[model samples]
Target chain A: MAINKLKRHIIIFVMFVTLMPTGTAIADFAVIVNKDNPVVSMGKSDVKNIFLGKKTFWPDGSGIDVYLQRAGKAHRSFVLEILRKSPQQLSMYWKQALFSGTGIPPNQLQDDQSVIKAVADNAGAIGYIAPEHIDTTVKALELK
Target chain B: MKLSRGIFCTFLFVLISLQETPTCLAFQIGNHLSLNGYLSQGYIESSGNNFFGDSLDGSFEINEFALTTNYIANNQLRLGLQLLSRDLGEEGNNEILIDWAVADYHWQDWLGLRLGKVKLPIGLYNQGRDTDFLRPMVFLPQSIYDENKRSLLVAATGGSIYGNFFLGNGGYLDYQAYYGKVDFREDSGQAQGIRYLVSNISRMKNLGSVSDFDSENRYVCGGSLLYSPPLDALRFGVSYFTGKTDFDFRVGGRKGEASGTNKDFIVLSVEYAQPDWKIAFEYSEFTGDRKALGIDIPDGRSQGAYVQLCYHLYDELVLSALYDIFYADKNDHSGSKYADQGQPDYLGWRKDFGLGIRWNITNQLIFKAEHHWVDGASLQLPIFNPQGVEEHWNYFVLKTSFNF
Candidate 1:
């Protein structure tokens, strides 16, 4: 009878752990721009175009300086979710643009902190990072 | 010896550059100018026929080197130029030539203009063929992108207008329209093919041996449209080109002038990509008319198509497979009518199955190997193969490339 009671307790504990709520299933990354920029929100397509080097200017007629992380979870999520491409595919796309003399790829930073710093420094710069990395120096753009 | 020296110098230069700046994607000369280049060396071997040199005996006469520079004057204007030197058997011969020099102006998201020597938007991959790292296969589908006709089809000296349009949930559209003139070199494969044709015609017409062959492209006009659906990694495209060429040849000390018009050259393409796999299909048709010495040659339409699939086994390794087909005359798929002539029936058609592997050792370095089993001689020009061509043949190629 004591062994059976211990088995039941173990089963109940396993079920409770499995049923516990995780904060959010998907980790959310934030797209950021300089605090002084006029842009507050942007559509997914607009972000895609800017990263692709197809959209060069912002609404205020200033050149947009795009920044990206070299390789990280935030980079992977941004590429797969927003750009609908793998990191390798994005790299190949940039290489194609370079070789074809079409456009230049954005400057790549090593980490989220570097990307955050880059966007914070340039008025027209834009980048993405983990939401926890967001600070007062940069404004997080609402992804439409 | 000259070829060896050229290869050595190019290899040494690339090695030094890589060592100096292994991580640089492009060397920046200043605030406005940036430079990039790539070098590729390839070896080819064949079983039954010569290809891209004396491939039957294992040829190393395939290589390419190019340097491209871009100067961004402002947010709206950019100037670009590329100097290229390549050798494929008897063509190119490692002579430096202008691949493209263009002045591009971007007005807005939906419009742009480019003037100067511009790369033609033929099928999907023509503009990127010079860059070995752009594709998984060492050679693209030969049926649609015949290596022999590369010079004639690569680019044109003219102007182009291009644009991209967003379609909300529908997708996006990219369009290009161009007008230009193509320059054909004397040592080019197109020129050699023309020479061979003139010689054969002379023999048939009893006009004696033909010599002093010259050809000029009068003008070319084309347009291309590509659409990407809302679905991820799916695209469909169509391209059309029309051009005319004038040729002059001396037959037994007599000068004769002829002209050829390419009417309704069209290509349709589709490609789909996933994270680890991609598939592409393209079909092309060329309808043309030829007149030689005021004698009308029979008009015919040629057709070509290919289906390619690529799978990435790892982040740096890719495997590709291809099935390509070509016909000299779309109406005579069996080549029975072609056999009525003296030439072999296989000359009228070609069917090929190819397999390739590409390894991206680094962001700036790549290596590739491919083999093709061919069942016809359609694009194998007689000028390159005095030893003759067999109906069943195969070829292998190994290539390595470095870029910065």
Candidate 2:
């Protein structure tokens, strides 16, 4: 009976992994920058680095200010697709950075609209929002 | 008693400050200044030996509290400091001290500088050892990160050059080189070891009573490099450090000095992480040479290593297992040679198998429990265990932490 229960747990775990969303099936969100910013396109690696705080400056030498949604579908999609990290992993990464005094995590907003508004007001700001939430005040980058 | 009062007051202040905003990730005074901290309390129990303060009968002597502040002067400059108070057995006693303080200047993605008391990069996890919320286990692998020698290896007061470099499609590399002097305290494990040695020497050579024991570091310097290859989620790293220290004491009203040098101290590390699980491995080796009171202690190379794995069962739960080993003298793994000198055979080595569970009760709160089956007595200092040590022992720990 114990063996059967263990086998059942293993099967369930495998199924969970198999059914998990890959995050690559659809590009439901757009990476956005301030309208005044000159950057037009970004590679996946570039976005990853910027989000990770590894890339701190733009070509114009302006500091990059990052914004993110605290929690939402768009936030999850961006974290999984662009950052290539699970939400929990990302949270742990930021916690590690904060506690170690190495770097600070990006400012998190409550939702997509807040992030979009924050990005629009800061010339050096970058954020992500669902395609339907993109507005004229922000320039959507062509993610490669 | 004073230290305990101070720690209580600090803890009260932190609690009061946190009451208003329970979910704040970091307290921000303004756009440029932020504060973060963590507090942990733990209990330990053991069978067959005492570990971390009379653990054979259970103890709550393990606890840590730290507060860090960061001020960003501009895009290129930042200042940070952390104040820490901890109690581990009879070591820390909850006395507050400066953990690390640094003024960091970032010039570019490939170049940066830091000046002040900087953390030493010994392994993949050394820099974050103080943050209990960062790992799945209550204690890190002791073979490589011996908690007893924490004061000697935690940080150094000086400067460092560091940076991250992109390698196009081949991933990236992070590097840091540092130089400074480490602080030595009378109650530190290293100092205790020196005192124990002096006591033995006093008996063997009729050197008489010893007192006023102290130690000083002449210098410490090191560098570390981490490379992430094209393989996703895989990282490889190597860190090296060397230093010299002097021990001073009085024997029979006569001053005596002993100097020790640590050479070729190195650690090699590798880790691979997936969405659900992670695995890590590290190995370290170093040679120590000492000359004390006109007697030259034979140079010995020590070795340590561990392999650990963690599985994320849920967003808030993690399970971890570790196998760690350490040899006081790599050439005498069996300890027979060490036993020939009158000490217990187990004194020369330690091997441990541990299992742990971590529950993230909340983003800012965590609970962890772990159990270990250990053989050997290398890390158990003789000064603390006057009754002698057992060849086999087991210990369990339960810890909870709150952070912001």
Candidate 3:
């Protein structure tokens, strides 16, 4: 009877391990803005506008500084989950804006840590990072 | 002497640029100045007929180089300029010239202004056509973005106003409205095509032929509107432009004029994007009236379209396929009228099946190869091919580019 009990426990543990590994690969991103930014909550549309250079200033009339990761896992997730654009699509969009002399792409940093630091240093800066990396230097915006 | 000078200047420029840090990131020199540039060369070979400089014997006459600069004068204003040198077959001749120069002012997202030479925002890809690193294929679809009419459609000298309206929920409407004038050179491929038509008209009517001909365009005006819904990856657009052109021809030592041929066009576009794939389609109709010439001319209504699909084979490699169609006259899809005139039926239209592969060798270098199986002779320039025309032909192209 004890041997049967041990076998059942082992089977349950194996099932748990197998199921956990199959969880969705899509990741959620935390949109981070400078702590001093007056805006409290942001919708996905607003985020898109800010990054695409449609919105140039914050509510207080201060110039908004946008930073982004060059291209990687975090960049992909942010574009997919927040901006709803693939990397290729976003590249095309930025190319049009650049060549047309209408707008400039956001400054690209090396990694999430650099993005966080950039936002923390500037009063009007905004960016995104993985959720676990969010800290006190920046405030994770509440998605509407 | 001129070729050697050009080669020397290009070498010096590249040498200087290489000494600086090479990165795709915007290169800033001061508080306001930023720079970007690229260089590309291509080789072409065809199974029949001549294209882009003696392709019947295989040609290496296609190349492009450009340097662009942008200056932020203040938070409200910016200045930009680009100098470009390009050659294709016997055209361009590798002459460096100002491609565009503009001063822009931003008042708000709802309103902004641009003055000077501004690139026309035509169709989906015209404004960004010069950038080699941005496209999946070395050449864009010829149906809508024909190589012969490139300069005529690229940019104009004047002013424009642009804006965007936010509709909420990731939806928005964007637009640009402009008025300007475009220039056409006498030696351009467009001029060759026009000459062919005029000579044919003279032969059929038994009237004097046109020679030493040229054209001038004026009072161009147009606008484009794009709408994006809340959907993840779909956008739609419609654009139209119209202008007046005067064609001057010399006959028997006397100058004759075809005044005010009103030219107009409309294009509709749709694109869908995914993580690893994209699909796009565009349809265009162009019309012109040459009744001012006081002679019978083929109805000047043309239509063209293309459907394209691209798939990412890997992070650095992509494969694309396209099916494009062009009709010289919308009313004569079968070319029967042209056939009645003793010309091949295929001369009235072009249908092309194309496949291409592009590999980004590194951040700064790229290689591309493409092939086309074409079923018509519509785009062929008779002046370049004294040997005659072919109803069916095939061509292959290889290109490499470096960007900094």
Candidate 4:
């Protein structure tokens, strides 16, 4: 009888863990720009173009400086959700562009903090980080 | 022994490079200067015919190395250059060459210009063939990226204009157009292949003392168009090229030229992708007219196609399978008619089925192995397979690469 009761408890525990909501587990990431930039909101297509080097300059005539976090879950999420590309596909596209002399990839940083710092220091810089890390030096753009 | 020594040196260089703990793959001297490079070494062996080296006995004379630099002058301008060195059996022979040098200007998302020696925007894989770390397989499908005629299709010295247009509803069109001339050298494998084809045609026509056949490029111009819809991961493209060449033939110590030889080709490609699996297919056709050495050959049409599938086994490992076919003459799938004219029938077409596996040792290091079972000899270079080719053969390849 005791063994039967223990098995029932184990099954309930496994079900509870498996049925939990994923939103609470995964952290929300946000697109960020320098505090001085006038960009208010951006569509997903606009973000894709900017990150892929298709849009070089902002509306105000300053160059758009792009930054990226080195390969990680956040990087993968940003590529899939915003850029609409798989990580491997993104890497392959960059390699082709680099070798063919068509364009260059964005500057890559090691972590979110580094990306935030770089974007904060540059006037027209843009990058992405976890939502909780947003501070006064950078403005988080709303995804449309 | 000489080949083994070369392999040793290549491995030693890779080992030494790995020991250095660099801050980044690219060197940043200032705000605008950045440098990148890559190196790869490969070994091939075959059961009957030779490819890229004395592969029948196994050799290591296949390698590729390149260095690239980029300068960002301003928001609208960028300049870049790449120098390449490569060897493939008796082909490239470790020759240092300029791969590409271009000045690119982007006025907007819809318009851009590239001027200088630029890579030919052919099928999807031509521009990245030498970059081993970019793909999961050691060699691309030979039917589309034909190794025998690389110089004829790889790059051009001239100018190009490209752009992307949004079609609304998540649809887009990407287009590229180029005008230029390709460079051909006497020592190139394409030249040797052309020489062999000319000699065979002359002999068949009973022309006397035909020798010293040389080829020169006149001009080439083409464009590629690709469409992508809002669909998950799908793309379709069509590319076309038309060019003219002049060949000089020496018959009985007399020089004669065949001018205005027209060459035209088209390729259609389709690809579907997901995070872990991808499928692709491409079909191409080449048509041209040949006349020289007091003999006239009718307009010849050839076709090649392949279907490839790749699956990621692990996060860093991939497995692939491909079926490739090439027909020297689309109308004559069987070489019986050509054989009746007193030559080998196996030259009519070739069919190959291949399997490959690749492992990413690190983001910067890669290892790959592949095997192929082939039937027919239509694409084999007669110079390399002088001992004659077997109708059916198999080949194996192993390669390693490191890039920064």
Candidate 5:
């Protein structure tokens, strides 16, 4: 009888912890471009190739450029969680592209606000920032 | 539908908030090691002229197929390797070799050491930048950074120390210093257990050691400082170096020994970089007789610089171009010039132009093509081809690269 009561108590405790509502959830975002971009959506793999300089130009040959914020912890984390790569890994990729004459480094902007503004104004521009920072001037497309 | 919209809004809020939160150090020592590698290929076809011995203003060929790999044992230690191949004019002619090997140790956030073979810290791109997958041009300015000549032992077989310091405004600073020798000899690629040494004056060899290398031993040091400022989008870096590349020099007949200087030249560099575009600029000149064969030929000056630009057109394409110039302030010569009356004859100034495109088929695959025009290459060897004209034979190059 004593053993049965202990087991029952353990089960109830486990249930309570497992079911508790912590109110925290993993975050996700829709990577967007200006509404004018022909691209509707892309997946993580597509984004990786685009940023890595593996893909040099756009499909239509209009040419593409970019604006990226300086490297930061939050930015790094978002890139890791969303794009699944560490900063060093990403740096190496850029290093290869930059030295090979395959592509140029992105344009650096002060913050998401500026990045959004620049990208929105230029049809050939692309960038990533917080979803909340998105304005009507630009559009956010979902990463497939 | 209403409920879905609310969920989406909450998601957006969380994403924005995450960008403002503080995070801990991501670099740490753990046994769950991670290994990374890069593969690249390049091809060139120039309507202009460049090549060793002859310049063919209109010859095009496949240039290189290469791959590199990095192995990180933990947050504190790392290893790297590179293999490259170039197919000459026909099926049987090929150039191949090991480009780098490094074993690094992290002592702290501000300092660390690397043992074994590694790149000598010279400029922003001399050692840090070189690879078909990384650069925005089909070729780095030949006038400024290409060292196919005696910069031969580009990567050394020695030790190096480096460090990084973080600054606010989303910026950071870094520096590196190195010491040691190189693997030099008739068959360096396969030779071993050889020691080399170089003396200061022309014929006063026998001063130190000479085993695997021709003859050399000297201290080396270099450093770089970078600022990103509050303008997050803009990053600027300046770098410098003073040291010996190789100490071994087999002097000709009499006074037959050579010694390289412990300190020879200095390099000044600046690099502006962004995700989609970056430009590298540098100037290198001699000092303290940093030389090999003859008593460290002091005061011979050489300087060069290049500006590169690249733009990604879309998902699978990129367009690029670069302009580079290298010449002696005292005289103009081609890539190869003999010593004349106390001065390096004339390794004329050179200008390079290029364009390219790349396509990524998948995470592990890519395809790229590029072209270059070489002009006034008076000092550069191997790549510089000579015709009657000072701007002689220029060749075109085309290559495809693959890695697993």
Candidate 6:
């Protein structure tokens, strides 16, 4: 009986070790603007609405222009970890908006550097990238 | 087609909504009756030329206004009704009967059946297209589903059967099927789909007399099957349908444009969600015949698909982007068109890239903005041809939408 109990203990311990999460699971995000813009803050919803086409103009009704890095590892991760949209739901919205004449989608840049460059020059431009990609041209707006 | 849409939207806003008041007030007599209904309203402002050469301007005023309500019967059943209107303007005279009907049914945590005037289960978006709360965008795409109001078939007429099916894999499926006849205004005087293209039922209207026009019927039968697997954060859906659509246009005084069609649609979707961040992608297509003028377009097939990526930064703010494409061709039987017109190719296609940002000021209230660049050609619309690309076109658009 003692031997059987000992075996059970071993199994449970093995399971615990196997189930423990490894590596860095924490996600980091940043709100990017043109390096030269004076605006410096935002809310999560404000960012989401701008991307979803729900808010066409800025808070003050300024013409807002949004840019994105082309389809790639960084772009994909940013969308999943920061944008909060899945590949499928976003696609459906695109077609629905386009065919219905509600709106068109955005122009895709080839990489993170390109996106950073675009957002850095335009006051109305907004986007996000990895914290490492942050440079002198673009400023990161801390979220509330 | 344009005329047919105007008439049907008008019918949806004017005709159907009128009948709802009487059904409610009639029951109000001799009762402490306080009746209320669900309300929904919105409008579409776009800038682009459509299939019919109509230009879309970027504008927004009021699109819909509705009030739907009901009464409780015994513990097992409820009686309900709705009054709806869309596309209201300041000076232009525009109104239609979008929804005005009553329903009676029983329900529980797992199963239910509703009967009366209700939304039709035509496409992924048609059933709930009018309510902005159910979707992120202002309208569902026309390539997959169109939500034009119709006068031929009852919006939520007769009855509908719905149930939940479990796949034993920690996944679930929702199924629904309905049987009813619809009122068409374009030709049958009922709008088939809402996007202003299929809204014109009068284009084929050859039937004579109001009686003949009002006497058309559309026997529609279809169902949707949805599945979400347990092994992955993925969802799948398949829809099948077969029915006889009636348009008011008459051949030999038949009083209806009776055309038979089959529908098959497939969807594959996936979602990877995490705290503070979530992303989703869905691909769907409709493959079947679009009945028109009693002709089953030969080689008539249409398809559409899109991919989107998004990031939620904070409570009401997010960033997103997408790529889209849709195509269709006119199944022409006339070996060829006039020599001057040649074989009259009607093939069409469009591809687009977009980026967007949105802010949700409140849970029920949202403000959104988006930008898009487009390429490709639509079979019946204006297009640009790149130096080496076939009929390549380019254009950009900016848009905004709000719902409460």
Write candidate 4's Cα lDDT for B333-402 as tens digits: 8977558777678877889899999887776778999999999887754567877777788888899987
* Residue A127 lDDT, candidate 3, scale 0-100: 92
Model 4 stretches astray by more than 4 angstroms: A1-27, A84-86, B1-19, B22-25, B201-214, B258-262
Predictions' DockQ, in order: 0.48, 0.50, 0.42, 0.47, 0.05, 0.02
Candidate 6: true contacts recovered, fraction: 0.00
Q: Write the per-residue lDDT of candidate 1 for residues A18-88, one digit (tens) a residue.
A: 89966446555789999999899999888987898767889978888899887888898889888878888
> What's the best-to-worst order under TM-score?
2, 1, 4, 3, 5, 6
- In model 6, state the lDDT of residue B111: 56
lDDT of 2 at B391: 83
Which residue runs of candidate 5 sit more than 4 Å off their true CA positions? A1-144, B1-73, B79-99, B128-130, B149-153, B185-219, B245-255, B259-265, B286-299, B330-346, B361-363, B382-389
Clashing pairs in 4: none
lDDT of 3 by residue, B1-404 (tens): 13443774576376546655465444767647877677888999987667667998998888777776788886668898877777888887777767788898987777889999888877887777766667778778888877877766778899899988988665888898889997777767666666666666666666676777988876678888888888867889888877776677875456766644436788899988777788989999887565324664555688999999999898578899999999988999998887998878887899989999988786667899999988887764456776777878888999998765
How much is A79 displaced in model 4, in angstroms? 2.2
Per model, kept true contacts as a fraction are: 0.49, 0.47, 0.42, 0.47, 0.09, 0.00
TM-score of every model?
0.91, 0.93, 0.89, 0.90, 0.56, 0.52
Model 4, residue A56: distance off in Å is 3.0
Q: Is candidate 4 or 5 superior in lDDT?
A: 4
Comparing to the true complex, what docking class would candidate 4 get?
Answer: acceptable
- Candidate 6 lands at a TM-score of 0.52
Instruction: Provide candidate 4's TM-score on chain A.
Output: 0.80
Give candidates' CA RMSD values in order.
4.5, 4.1, 4.7, 4.4, 21.6, 19.2
lDDT of 1 by residue, B1-404 (tens): 13354664565486545566454345665658877778899999998888877888998889888777788897788999987888888888888788888999988868899999988888998888788888889888988788887877788999899989889888889888999999988887767776776777788889888878888999989989989888878999999998888889899899977777878889999999887899999999987687776777665898999999999999899999999999988999887766887678898899999999999898779999999999988885467777677889999999999887
Model 4: DockQ vs. true structure = 0.47
Q: Rate the local accuracy (lDDT) of all candidates.
A: 0.84, 0.85, 0.78, 0.79, 0.49, 0.48
Error of 2 at A12 (Å): 17
Q: Indicate which candidate wins on DockQ.
A: 2
Model 5 CA RMSD to the hidden true structure, in angstroms: 21.6
TM-score of decoy 2: 0.93
User: Cα deviation in Å at residue A68, candidate 2?
Assistant: 2.9
True contacts kept of 1: 0.49
